[model samples]
Target: MSALLPLPRLPLTALAVAALLGAAAGVWPGAGIASAQGTAPTTQPSRLPTAPAQSRGTAEQASVDGVVEAVRQTVLAAQVPGAVVALQVKAGDRVKAGQLLLRLDARAAEQTAAAGAAQVRAARAAQDAATREFERQKQLFDKAYISQAALDRAEAQYKTAQAEAAAQLASAGAARTQSDFYLVRAPYDGVIAEVGVVLGDMAMPGKPLVTVYDPTALRVSAAVPQTLAAKLPADAKVQAELAGAAARITPVRTQLLPTVDPATHSQTLRLDLPPGTTAVPGQFARAWLPVAGSGDARVLVPAQAVVRRAELTAVYVAGADGKPLLRQVRLGRTEGAQVEVLSGLTAGEQVVLDPQAAARIR
Candidate 1:
């Protein structure tokens, strides 16, 4: 009766586990906890045999679900605060590097730059007058027409004017640089995935305005438990199945992140999709990474063999006497027509194919 009890406090029906199973959705239904009180005595199922890893396929211990992402995705942000004045591109538009994407109001920056230029011109004129006056004073002092004190005053004024001119020139250059910020350009050649602004929208520094991504290069990213991370091989043949796609994606490269996520106790797994693998960012995908060695190799049984019930997943095993006993098992990734058994069953053991028939035998 304890086995019949719900896994936790809540007693939900078997239907709750199916949708959440994701890629494991192809199995048959049988999710109830059978117990001694049920008074069922069962015999071996109609078909009895051990399904080996070689027969099902040399695959992963479990499947890790992930999302397809572009290898180079960037979000363009505003560096200068202004209202959007012109929008040159929208979502789905292809743009070249340095191509104009949008424009912001630059009337204020333009005025500032103009004023700085004017100051530079005025300071240069002052510097020219000061230089001529200093030269004339030096000539007068050399000929004894002016005192040394008078010549020194003229030299000081000339130096001051030269410093003012240099300062104004630098200020003008900075103003000119800031004035160019009103135009926003793409950093690379890619397709625009999103546009977060419209004409007349007020833009602020660091505000995201566009999202672009390269379609030629992409990958699917998934997170796997750290316990299993050590067993993934760098050259392992990782395969990915995209939602609604018939073909499985073969990755050109597999990358395992060195750092573990403290909160999830998992590490990120990256599978670089092969070139021209028709996939877009944000699409859902399931990846199967081959674990190193066969020491902990798992078994796969037909989905019909496992009974899902009351938020619990269990299966019926045939004993040596051909009598069946209900055993609880933890479920792993579900591939087409089969599910991986993580625990509660050993290799070479006979698993009843039909849970309904096994329930009758029990």
Candidate 2:
């Protein structure tokens, strides 16, 4: 079964970005883009052919698939091996921090801890005896009843016992801590998304027992092409269309992870959703990101000027002899009435705005 909640009417930005991901994007299929700057092919307005849009605008918008994720989540894991004796919470249960979520049979751990305690007591008794002996030896040395060598031996024995006692105390404390790990507790206030172990199940150290997430702290994670990510403005405006939400929502903050994926050539973009927004971890979302940069400027043409055929994207260009010649061109993003041309037809070239009209003239 699909784990994701079904998304609503697909966002337009998602489709646009997904379609124009590669180097040679054929999104427009011979669509007209703005003509190059400083060059205009003089053509009559009523003529069958016209120049591409005269102005090259720079602002661009892109969209990509985003997934809702919790900003804070934890998968509780067992720190000591034991049999699962009790499970206090199941999936979807809300819990507070430090709340007991599961209990493990700690009979073996209890024995180990008791053994550690006995060792500590034994060490302390030995240390006390050593102390008394050293005191007695010091007094004998002072009164000349014992030799200096005998006093020094007693002092060394006392110090050795003191060290042993300290070591045993630390060992006992560690044993007690390990025993406490047999009782699993929630790390934070969150909903239990998963319960990995059942009563009577044997849990090994490092095995996950429960998954919890804070439902209120959510963000949208999307992967954007490196080219688009590099061009994103410092204060770029971001908007999101969350699954099941009535309208688009703005992110409270935007962040871009520095590392880029080697395989996909994309970087992860995270947008923190505002508080009180209805969203769940793993839900689908679409984010519109603004792409801004400067270059030689884009060539845009009217969408109606595009001529598409099987694997063919071209336009009828006015030849030197005033005849129509089909010219192939690569395309880019669409802006309202016009699309960007990545290559092929350039400035000073007369492109037929209406392919049908040019066909009749030919």
Question: What are the TM-scores, per candidate, against the unseen true structure?
Answer: 0.62, 0.61
lDDT of 1 by residue, 1-362 (tens): 35675556766555666545633866434433334446665543555443332134344445688999999999999889999999999999999999999999999999999999999999999999999999999999999999989999999999999999999999999999998898889988899999999999999999999999998899999998887777877567778889888778778888888899999999988989988888889999998767755346657877878898898898888877776678999877677888878788776678777677667654
Task: List CA RMSD, all candidates.
Answer: 20.5, 24.9
Alpha-carbon lDDT of model 1: 0.83
Candidate 1 backbone clash number: 9
Off by over 4 Å in 1: 1-54, 57-62, 141-144, 234-253, 274-277, 292-362
Off by more than 4 A, model 2: 1-60, 292-362
Top TM-score hit? 1
- What does candidate 2's lDDT look like per residue over 129-244, in tens digits? 99999999999999999999999999999999999999999999999998898999988888999999889999997898899999889999999888888788889898888877
